[model samples]
Target: MCAFIKVSIATFAVCNRISKVLGFDDYKFIATPVVLLMLSFSIFVTQNTMESHFSISNIWQYYSFPFEAIIPFVVFIVAEIRRKRTKVL
Candidate 1:
């Protein structure tokens, strides 16, 4: 859990920086879909390589929701807070 939070924040930070440097103010929106697609593709590939079955169980599907949904939501919230703070200064 700790590792997941750390990696998620770090990934968001790096992608945020890159987007800024590339002049994209709405980078979070773009990054979210791309990251999700990559994650889904990787999971599919990994399951194919290691498991006899390619399908993910419903419980495991539920487990993935937080990582996919929560992390980006947190990142967006944090980014919004920071943006507001900087604008106020």
Candidate 2:
């Protein structure tokens, strides 16, 4: 229930980008389609095959290592350089 609410509100915020005042009716309008789409996508991705699960995990592992581990160090180095130039610390 909590997860559904969080995801729905996030979907609503992303979809409701128009620069005008909208009320609860507008929210429901956007949220209803988002919820439907989420349900449909869940149905589509529900494969019980172990091969599919293994392939998905392999792809995530391949990408997650360099991006998750190395990118943080690069960001920290860049921030440190900027901080040194400004003498903030």
- Compare the candidates by lDDT and give the number of the best one: 1
Best by TM-score: 2
Cα lDDT, all candidates: 0.77, 0.73
Question: Which pairs of residues collide in candidate 2?
Answer: none
Per-residue error for 15 in candidate 1, Å, reads: 19
TM-score of 1: 0.39
Q: Which residue runs of candidate 2 sit more than 4 Å off their true CA positions?
A: 1-13, 16-28, 32-51
Q: How do the residues 34-79 of candidate 2 rate in per-residue lDDT, one tens digit apiece?
A: 6688779766776566756886778768868899989999999999
How close to the true structure is residue 21 of candidate 2, measured as C-alpha lDDT? 55
TM-score, per-candidate, Cα-based = 0.39, 0.49
- Candidate 1 — which pairs collide? none
Reference-based lDDT, residue 34, model 1: 58
Residues 66-86 of candidate 1 have per-residue lDDT tens digits of: 999999999999999999999
